[model samples]
Target: MESLNKNQLALLTCVIALSFSETAQASATALSPSSPGTPYSQLSNKVMAISNERIDKQLNQEINKVNDVMATRVLAKIGDFSSY
Candidate 1:
């Protein structure tokens, strides 16, 4: 799971970087250089923010799964002592 998360982070970073690069190149060639607050930059920022939120959700889900597994195994080992 850790490895999977690392791979996902790497892939996401690469994809976003590539997309930003492509957008920058396209803008440079097709129009004036983009300023800091331009629509293109704003769009890129929004994409990054959204991706970050998604990553956080994925990590939280993974954590919950691990917690559930641990709880189940602990209960199995402890057995039912309530009857005593």
Candidate 2:
């Protein structure tokens, strides 16, 4: 098999490291709810519910980013095979 050049190897390493870091960060963030001491703390229960809803929305966005990356990778493999 042909070896990767330095630039190609570096780019691959960087992409892998970034993916790992993003997965780790999302996992960590998913473990905790938004802190009560922030502006959400000062609001009534109804407003606090809205704030929590927003937090959930943001969490879903992060999760979607991870999913999108995985989907892109799968599609790339499919494209590679179909090109033959």
RMSD values for the candidates in order, in angstroms, are 7.9, 11.8
Best by TM-score: 1
TM per model? Answer: 0.47, 0.39
Q: Residue 36 in model 1: shift from native, Å?
A: 14
In candidate 1, stretches whose alpha carbon ends up further than 4 angstroms from where it belongs are 1-38, 80-84
Which residue pairs come into collision in candidate 1? none
Compose the digit string of candidate 2's lDDT tens values, residues 1-84: 133255445655665565555545554454345654545334445454444555555556655765687699899999999999
Number of clashing residue pairs, candidate 1: 0
Angstrom error of the Cα, residue 54, model 2: value is: 1.4
In lDDT terms, which candidate is top?
1
lDDT for each residue of candidate 1 in 30-54, tens digit (9 for 90 to 100): 4455554467766667556655665
- Please give the CA lDDT of all the candidate structures: 0.63, 0.57
Residue 9 shift from truth in candidate 1, angstroms: 12
